[model samples]
Target: MNIKLLSGSVALALTIGVGAVPSGASEKPNVVLMLADNVGYGDIGAYGGGAMRGMPTPVLDQLAAEGLQLTQFLVEPGCTPSRAALMTGRYSVRSGLGTIILGGLPNTLQEEEFTLGEMFKSVGYSTAIVGKWHLGFEEQSWPTRQGFDEYRVGVIETSESTLYRPNMERARIDEATILEAVPHIYESDGQGNLTPVREYTLEYRRQIESDIADAAVNYIARQAAAETPFFLYIGWTHTHYPSLTAPEFTGKSTHRYGDAMMELDHRTGQVLQAIEDAGIEDNTIVLWMSDNGASPDAAPWPDKGGSNGPFRGELGDPTEGSIRTVGMIRWPEKIKPGKTNEMVAIHDILPTLASIVGADLPDDRPYDGVDQSAFLLGQQDMSKREHLLTHVNNKVAALRWRHFRIYPKAYRGSFSNPSQEGLLGVQVEKNGGPDIFNIEMDPREEYSISGDNAWVVAQWLRFVAEYNESLREHPNPPGVTLTDPDFGK
Candidate 1:
């Protein structure tokens, strides 16, 4: 893996072909993008789990029935990377956020990177993000600084930080010291100033989703009343580690994970109901999706984790289960309600939404996402995307071209160290060249038909080669890794 550090400005320009909004499309639709944390492909009822997984998601299932359900929606392998891809419409590596970010790290979303909030705001839409903003804690990377008009009821870190104080107490740490270091839920003043609302205790964690839902619902009502086209991003913290439910939903399901799932469904329903009450259902584009797949580490916990359907790998692994998760988009009369197996990725959302709202994308840098507005609006049956490169950190781990998944390196996991699999598994170099699996035929990737599908490898290599060639012109910024000599410098 030859990782080149990005230096100076590189003229690796890209031209994206975006479809125009439909004829007579007068009103720009309001967008509500809800991103779930660590929910899997099989976590929801719509994707064939729900009741079977001991958690019934009726709201999500109904949303799927009333809109377009994606069977092959893909994302990055971790939380920060997935969010970066969705916000920038480019590979997370381009923004130097190719992996999960740790606290006190210098790695942050740079101010120069264009975000979805900035893009929507450029088109005169009022934008806000309510909930998890894990990109960075720096003021430069704050949601307000990134072009959002408002940032409320959110955390700048992962949900697991809620357990920090408890874990410190168990280790017999000093109470006052622990209190000083505890994470807090924050609210921003539409400028770069952030105010801590409260300590993110376990009790608060249980009801955090409810608070996020409340803020988002209230924002929607206000925006609707003001008659402003709005882009509301609701980041729901549920089904993540330390899965806890509010008092109302504590025992509503079979287990901790089920309870959390139920809470997630209810909170999501509350936001959707707000949209309906505002009478903006017809002109509102609602997208419900999960950040990544389930964490196998959660399986050993009391919550028992989530189901990645029949897919074999867990969250953060460069496998189908890690990248392929639930995705649904609803726009009453504009987008037809139907399910499709056509591939669409997290990075595609920015360009697709830009196309739908008639916004222009900046052409100075390269973007991995193509405009899928035509396919999304039912103007075309097939998706515009045909290939997606799966990256683990700065390295290209795998390639998905059409129905084939080609892997230049194989992932091998051991029973003694299951958690290590999330870090792209213990990579093993294949001596007989790359392994090719027909994803449609073997969704679990149990068999490698490399001998039979030799031609597919040649085609997949071209995609990889093209990506590498682009990197030569526009090299990626240094991605997070454990082996960097200048650690935390």
Candidate 2:
């Protein structure tokens, strides 16, 4: 095992119990976190969505009704960045992943950082990540080294997908780089070693989601019978560009895009059923969400793709449609079934779970996430998160406080738009008045109140000032990106 220990003073101190768990909760609840790739805000039934023009997502809708639905959950604009934030409970930029991993190059989470998987393992919880482990593709950086006990991962660079070739064409990746991007599956044994399983190609692409879900179901049953709590992360690769639908679900929706989403719903339903069958549904915490908003301009999986519903802009932009996404949690009798208008982000998951498990966060580094256990447990009506900093390529693209958002300047892109070349000379001006919107009232961001609402504008600017001060107190540098030298042929 090649586990790199944390260095310096930060590694010297370890503090637990940052948030008080409710009394009389003895047994640690099992956790199952499901993440969809490139899904839109309105693409699920609970959010008024179906796979086709208005396909019905009965399973998701039922899950929302039985769980708590968060209306304004935010995530990073891209896949790798979002996953990084969710795992580390900090800004992706702090993890050197403010942007997606470039083609032919590998980017990974640092060894020093503590992850959600590690946090669970700290409390003696069995952990497994059954799908995409995009945090890092390198040997030492894989999930096994990061704390997962068992892993079934598909290794792919950010440029590759279920439909790898089409993505290469869209990104204009050279043939050599494209050849280096073959998709392969491997299983890990919670060490630095991995055993190759099979090649993931178009013929078998459609079955990936089902296979992952099946693996999760089996894990759940085994954990339940053994009397040990477990953490299962199902990273479903669906609804992204070149959305692949299983053969059985083909033509099940109005279009190929819808078909893919429908398939996602089906696979999710299977996992939920497994929880029920294992008789751990009430004692388990099930969470559903997406990595980020969907991109309508994704050329590889084009089919009048994705509807951000009323929100404006698309993935890769600072707009609400890019960050705000569908979020739900079902814990049977523990979590009251209802909805919350709270402002939460992917970064909050780690701290929230830490509080629930009565565990402590690492005392050494800066953590951007807050404990939302109180909010989830119904101890409080409001979320602990009050403000969020939205970024694009390490630059603060927008500042969000309460119900308002202030975009520093005009920005545009969705998935592959406004390439790295476009980001080079990009200038976000502060001289001209900023564009502000009361996201609560105008979810679409159609109207700007920056010119009319003086109080709101002043309040937002004040928040930014305070945030800047905090950033200075605990300065953060981006994580390291892998170069050819570090790739280790």
Candidate 3:
């Protein structure tokens, strides 16, 4: 993996497809994108966990009740790829972030890509990203440089142990040692300057989530009081690996992971309450989603991390559970409260919001996302998005047709251990004997319909062929640097 920065327009070609057209409404709604780091599909009460799991998420449940609950929402298998897709409205492959960034490497996001912040800013909407920013750690790739007007960023590159790798291997990591491994925090002015706000420590890690909620609420108040429309991207870092529960939330749930989940749900309610208190609830479009599927192996405790509900597989797997998670959108009086089984993904948010705000997406590159504003707003009966190409790392793991999914290989990973590789887990071949699944019926992906579903395989192959051709024409290298020739390794 050669880690050279691809020239902006030269590397990423311009090829725009049709997306959703904007409505004639002159008053654009304020946008609040609340992202949960690793919250699972079954973690919230709306999805079924709630008090039964020792964590009652009443806030998230209510949000779902008052909004559109999308059951088939998808995302990338990991953090970097998911964030890249969400920000650019394109696949992580296009931006070279198909994998997670490791250690200290150059930024994952290239300077040329269009981001959500930049798009909202282009439409005269103030933009800010609070909490985790895993795209890049370098100056040019920071959120402030990527189109945000103001941001509070944390954790550039994830640490394996936050201590010397060699020493950590032999050292017994206790509470004190773990606290010493916390990630640093910073505040940006949306310009080129970044000021150090708090150094990484165990104490900071414990209170960081609460602090982020405070900052977001304050920002919302200020923006609303000034009568300014703003785009707030709150990427909550709770429920991720090394899940830490705040003091107030500790022991509130059955387990540590559940405790963290409770805290995150409470904070989400706080943010939503702030919006209501600002008297802008009716004028704000609030979207709550998780970055990826839950991880069963996050904290190493029994039944810790998150649950993908009835879906099989964990975070890194290409199965339904790894890519499928919770997604909800709320706009009082604008979007009717209901539920839809439509297949929406993280990448769709950018284009959908762009269409709603009458902002133009860059026409220079092919985008994997389709605008679903019409479908989401009840203007269209069915979603315009029908196919989803599921990829893990740089490989096209599986492709989903309307109700069926076809995988080129058999995934044999268990709930305790997850694997993304198998004999045929590469790109799909035209005449490959891939495994087929009616995911709509078997959301767990336990049964294969390959022999009975020849048409599904053929359709999946066609979609793969088309996407492969696009890749051949554009030739996008992975954005993340762990695989780079001499970058991190």
Candidate 4:
């Protein structure tokens, strides 16, 4: 591995409460990253939904109160893309995973790509990923191969795959054939051994998050007893399509989605409680965030219980609501608890965590994420990040710089085909010029202020030009596309 170690001065500067470490505590802190699927900005109480949306997330709301809430945390347009960025600290397009991966698709996280789990392992931390591993289905793409030391109670595909067996039954397919085709809940021993634990049935789907929470809690307990620090990535399946409430949580809220939210909140509390019980609250860093904005295509009418707060657009569009979601981080006494409008993206997590653990990033590849350890530690008044580029299907859809959102290619939700829009929306390519919106004043993005902000467009173009120039030396891998004949090659 091409690695660089941080100097003593740099490492000490990043530590909070420098001289206040407990006698035998490890120098590096344990990191727990909880990622919720298809949750919107307004879905959580801290962002404005919660009780008002008929699902009171007391545990999550309280977690926000005790931590630093991020009002403008950004992600990619879909689950796979967001996860790819979170793992690699680079744009999803660079990894050829700019869109959601399908079951039989060849798009996988390559062995050459260094992941967050590998980074943590490099610094002597035990690493594990519990829950959804959607990067690919190949053995080489498994979590164990990517960087996680253990993978448990998870699926290699999306939650929607739970419906495959029933759908196949409706088509009069044989049970044996259906069983052969559908995926099952799997676990890995981090030694090239992957095993199927159980069938991923719809009934199992209802209790999947609960199962994941239990596994994560167990992992935390075991690691707390060890000398090495740990990194746990929990990919929660909640508020996604086919949202099902566990038997215990049924009718707890107004709708199925709300009931699922209640379950998510409660199960997350279980993991938090485990951390507290293990007596590692002061030394552990926990980050709770959503992978993407809510999906209107998940359900219809009252059952479709998700809001984008004040932003426009939904999950798959290149709009504010599509990419922006809830994000919060807590590290007792180290980070002050408050809300900030400063920008942060999913890709920044790996680099930020690497900085906190005193591990140098690999020098073999270019990284899009800048280290925000100083800003996050309260040493700076503003975030180090000022601009972010959003992509869909490997193409530049929008650019967010400061308060301005510039769209070279715009899209809108299609009423005729909501599901199609949620995957790949209807594009509006010819808009005279780039559309600009001052997100601070117009959060909904109702009117374009491009005519008045010509300078903003100029700045955006310059950034894009520089990025394009860098591609000459290190071109991105082939992006996955349905129409590409050589896809997965």
Candidate 5:
């Protein structure tokens, strides 16, 4: 069992022939979904980014080289909403999560729903979530309750805190270089509550990175040894805030962010190598997508840099630059290495993965995500997903169906902060989009189409009506308590 890492191109060719195999080929291919928080579409080598010139992201680059690069990918304009959609394959609004969830926010994702981890676990795959668990800080909605058999990361604020603690949650300081110092850690039941985890500075954070990697590798090897197939979701916590990395990768990328990403790249290689070592590389499908658009001030203090390429927006916007990102799928046995401009959203992954694994998705609950199993497996001529929807910021909503996009004149921020603006530089009037353009040509979304484009205007109104109707279908907000869960009363 040696590393069978294929360049994106070579892997694609090997997988094209795998499409005709009967469904559930080689058992459920191990699923390793790795997401970098707020990473832009152009941050990786395959995306033509220059900042990572010497960063040497062989792992991620190889993934793109051997797999299918989904160019027209979409996500929530912000983290919570996008992650909510990803975890459940339903729009965040449908799940009662509108925007970012602070530590104390009530109404965590309901445990009653079928989570992505749960679905995979149900289908005889071992599921684990390591890294940001932003879904619900409440233990009831925590990874353990949400279907993950094992987890090694902290809750929501866990991400924004610090990246290099022994437990990977607390901050530590070395006597001299602030090098990989491990600090005391705490555990939470997912809610804001907390308890001690480990002693401070006892374990270096760098060791934890290797530990997480080791856990994954061991999981794969164990599954293989036991003659059982498995699913491993390696949610990396790098390329994120407090951008820290293994000392080996420091200065490797030249800049702070580059170094952080460089470590991320190298760590990714380790995980892939483990998968191959387990001899499941060819049958495993590794899905890589960013949780949201690029964040501002990624490094050098007040200045942030995430190469969004030609896209002209950042996180927290409804614009293409904000919601659109890079998505890569590498299944050596099922897909060919090539690029597709299919308009995809994170929601689409649930159905695609579930169907591929022969798992049944619940029909009782609505899945806003489209099942593009055919597209991902390279069996279909194109995509079955014609449109994508977005709802981030406060309460603003949008639609991306066919060539049209619609936004209404009125929508409040989350109930608590009604007057807050949801998006920047864009205005919603009785007349939506004073400026709109084809997403292909106007990725900037800077052109106004309200007065000139008749068809788009009509489409806009139609979408708005549909959205309003959907809103009515949802329970109306409760009186006076805008921030609580009762708003959906």
Candidate 6:
């Protein structure tokens, strides 16, 4: 079953064919949701990034060209909000993930809200999530209780945890802990408990320990024959700040990021292969998108060479770079195979998938996300969501309506990274001050001008106050804004 390449084309030929469906056509397609951490837009081949100045991802490009490559996809300005949106299909502030999730804080994604994993599993799809999950860490909100049949990876401390072997470099890329030879550990009982079961040092090592790809393949191999369909949400912690590389991938590209990108591509190919090998490729929907923009675009490391391509803002800044990043979906049986300029928000995935599986969401909860099922099916004219909201923990907020991105005047900077691409950025500064930039027409925010647009900015500020008021009404509201004693005085 060799995939015959043309006379001259790709070096490693791949046979893309799926003939196994477990005799269940009405059982809904198996879904694989792949999420990237802190990856920029132009790093991949499918996005018109030339190899000269960009990384080459043939496998990813092939996936986009053969599926749905969303050009205007947007997410939260940081990892937590972006993840929260992907899981609940709700805005970050509404779900209490407007800021990064760390520092042993009890505040996490509320258990009351339904996650995509939980939603799909309830409707009979065997669900599993592997890789970085910054949404929550406590038992109440762990992946096991959230509907995953199998959870392989730590629920918390992944951003801080790194591995080599026993008595190796206690040097951590994020947060350091004393341990040994821990590569891929599995958490059973719903992330309540964990144990180490496997370790690979060669071909599989790069995909497993560093990429979160092998566990995904294992899940597919084990369930490819099951009578029930499956939903696998595979998240990878690659290209994120404090970037580490597998030994083999260290010098794989011009920059450290290139090696990471190549490693990600191999992982992508593996997941696709798992589906194809199981003969479920034609019957599965693969949703892939980055969480946010990039870190330097948002925080302390602005010199990291992370670019938002043509995006104005970087990450937490409310500019296009901050919110808009990579998004694409592949489904042979559902979505149209091509590219789309149709603007879509990051919060639209939840209800859309729920419809496909015929699942019911909580009746009492109000979700700000609109179901873009029609848009997915090639019927473009489906919605009129006037504006998309951009929220920073306390620094700033805005209403994004089409080309006009208006913001509140006299607003402090955001606690989230300045850019939305998911790069780590400095938090709020004590010299916390007011600054303004026309995000679309002027992105760098170099020229601060709250003077000329004072009137319009004032109106936007009033709207932000009202938005904050609504958040306060929630059971778990966001942190207060205008921290100093200067708000009311």
Question: What Cα-based lDDT does every candidate model obtain?
Answer: 0.83, 0.74, 0.75, 0.83, 0.63, 0.64
Q: Give the CA lDDT, 0 to 100, for residue 244 in model 5.
A: 58
Pairs of colliding residues, candidate 3 = 13-364, 14-364, 14-365, 15-364, 96-478, 96-479, 96-480, 97-479
Give one clash count per candidate, in the order shown. Answer: 0, 6, 8, 0, 26, 27
Residues 1-489, candidate 3: write the lDDT tens digits: 011111221121111212222343336788999988877888888888877788899999999999999998999887788899999988787888887775454447888988999988887888888888888766778888899888775555442223343355457666575445445677875355777766655456678789889999999999996645789999898777556768898888768888889899999999999999999998899999998887775434543658889887767657777788999999887688998888888988887787677777766677787777777777768776777787764778888777887788666643334433221123334465888878768887878777777777777767777777777657786454343387544
Total residue pair clashes for candidate 1: 0
The sequence of per-residue lDDT tens digits that candidate 4 reaches over residues 328-372 is: 999999889999989988878887887677666677676677666
lDDT of 1 at 224: 92
| Candidate 5 per-residue C-alpha lDDT over 229-266 given as tens digits, one digit per residue, 9 for 90 to 100 | 56677666656555655777666756666776677777
Candidate 2 per-residue lDDT over residues 404-426, each given as its tens digit: 88887855432434432122223
Ranking by TM-score: 4, 1, 3, 2, 5, 6
lDDT by residue for model 6 over 29-60, one digit each (tens)?
88999888777776667765526555678888
**Model 6 accuracy (lDDT, Cα):** 0.64
Whose TM-score is higher: candidate 3's or candidate 6's? 3
Task: Tell how far residue 130 is off in model 3, in angstroms.
Answer: 0.5
Q: What's the distance in Å from true for residue 30, model 6? A: 1.1
Error of 4 at 251 (Å): 0.8
TM-score of each: 0.92, 0.86, 0.87, 0.93, 0.80, 0.77
Error of model 3, residue 49, in angstroms: 1.2
Clashes of 2: 6
